[model samples]
Every structure is written in structure tokens, then in C-alpha cells.
Target: MEPKPASASRVEVTHLVMPGDANSLGTAFGGMVMQWTDLAAGMAAMRHARLPVVTASLDQLSFLAPVRIGHMAILVAHVTAVFATSMEVNVEVSTEDPRTGERRRCCDAYLTFVALDDAGRPTRAPPLLTESEDERRREREARVRRASRLALRTALTGA
Candidate 1:
């Protein structure tokens, strides 16, 4: 398959935080935020492969700030790198202040998704092409993350 630029698989989603999705503290529930983060990552992976994808793992999920009810939660996801059959997706989430229109990053997450064929077996995803400096940097950082994951897995399983 031909390589595709990162922009081709970039996805941005915004949702209004509701009271039903928040905790007693009036901040968005962690589960609710994770749901949106996974959706954004899944969309980006699907766009890159044009095939059905399954989430392999979620890494480095951090809740940096609170998202209040009635605020807008914005998430941006993109393919940082494509392995043989898996894509590494990076998601950045922010909260928008309705009154002042200010935005502050609230979360950062990394997810791995594996493309699947019609028979449900893992399939190769198109290579990710980096066009800009930022994209290239992301790709490089993704490589390091991948290495770290493998190292941890090997240490735990002795495989």
C-alpha cells in the first residue's frame, strides 16, 4: 500500500461535558474522558488503514487538568507511526472555557491499534509519511515509545 501523510489520518473531536458524565466534584469523569480519547484514536487508525481496527493497547494516559461540566472537551488524534500491522496513535485533549474561550490541555494519551482483514487476522497498515518537522518528531518519539513498551513487556514476561 502507498504511504499516506499524517494529515490524512488526523482526527479532531469535540464534545460538551454534561453533568451526567461528570463526578460529584463537577469535573468530567475519568471514564468519560477515556471513552472520547479511545474514539479519537480509533478513528485515526481506521483512517490510516482504511480497514477495521482493534485497539491493542493504551499507554501514557495522563489527566493533567480537570474538565468542568458545560465545558467543551476537544481531542485531537493522529497516526504517529505505522508498524507492520499496527499504528501508534497520539491523542491530545484540552478543555475549552466557555466564557473566556481559553483552552488548556487536560490529557495526553497514546494508543496502539492493529488493522484487521476480512477474515479477522491482523493486516498491514499503510506506511505513515511525515511531511513536516512536527510530524517527523512525532514519528521519532513514537519509535522510542514502541521500544519502551517492548522492553517492559519482555521484562515482565521474560519472552
Candidate 2:
């Protein structure tokens, strides 16, 4: 069977921070941000793969700022790269203030997800159809990001 098709636009998911999702300081926990990352990335992956998918790896996650209780956390995910059975999804998390409705970036990450079959095994994803200049541009930019990641990894491991 063929894989499903990815959306040309982004998939944005939003969550509100309640008491349960906070830390002792009443700020959102990093683990919670990570969980949202996986969820948003998986959605983007499903769009890219046209099938159910699972996280293969999270290349990097950086928390730039803290999210407070009563803040609205939004995740925006987009397809960054596509391989035979996997696709890289980039997710950005931002927080909106409750009173003034101000928004600020909180975190960003790159996650790779692999399509799965009914048995929950890896399966081939659909080839990305770049129908617009924007898609081509995004793919190119993703390649650059991937190269930068590899270089950084090599430097860190001295490999």
C-alpha cells in the first residue's frame, strides 16, 4: 500500500499550561515541552508519510525560555527532510501571555519520525512532492540544517 500525503502547509497545535504541567516554580517542565515536541513532530511526520508514524530520534531540543502557568503554549511543526522511510520535522514552541496576549518563543527542536506498518514496524514513506518554490526552498534549507547538525555532531564526538 502507498503512504499518505503530507500537507503543504504547517500543522500547529496548542496547549494550555495548567497546574499539573508545571514544576515546583510553577513553570512548565522541560519534559512537558518534550512531550509536546514529540506530538507536534509526529503530526508533521504523519502528514509527510501519509501514514501513522513514530519518533525515531530527536536530533536536538533547546529551551530558550520558560513557560509560566496560565500561558498558552503553541507548537508549530513543518516537514524539514524526507528519506525513504523517515522524515524530519521541525517544531517551534511559543508561549502566549493570558492577560495581554503577548507571545514569545520558548523552545525549538528537530525530530525525525519513521512511518510504521500495522505491526508497528518501520515502513517506507511517500516521496515528497515539491509543487511550489516554497517547498523547494524549505527542502534546501533543511538540507543545510542537516549538514550543520552532522558537522556539529562530528565536532562533539571527534568522529
User: What is candidate 2's lDDT per residue for 1-159, written digit by digit as tens?
Assistant: 443334663689989999899999999999999998889888788766668998766776678889999999999998866877778788889999989999999988887788899898888877776667876787788778767765886888886
Question: Per-residue lDDT of 5-124 in model 1, one digit per residue for the tens?
Answer: 989999999999999999999999999999999999999999999999999888967799999999999999999999899999999999998999999999999999999999999999
Cα lDDT for residue 75, model 1? 97
**Model 2 bad stretches (over 4 Å):** 1-9, 131-134, 144-159
RMSD of each: 1.1, 3.3
Clashes of each: 0, 2
Model 1, position 90, has a per-residue lDDT of 91
- Quote the positional error of residue 157 for candidate 2 in Å: 12
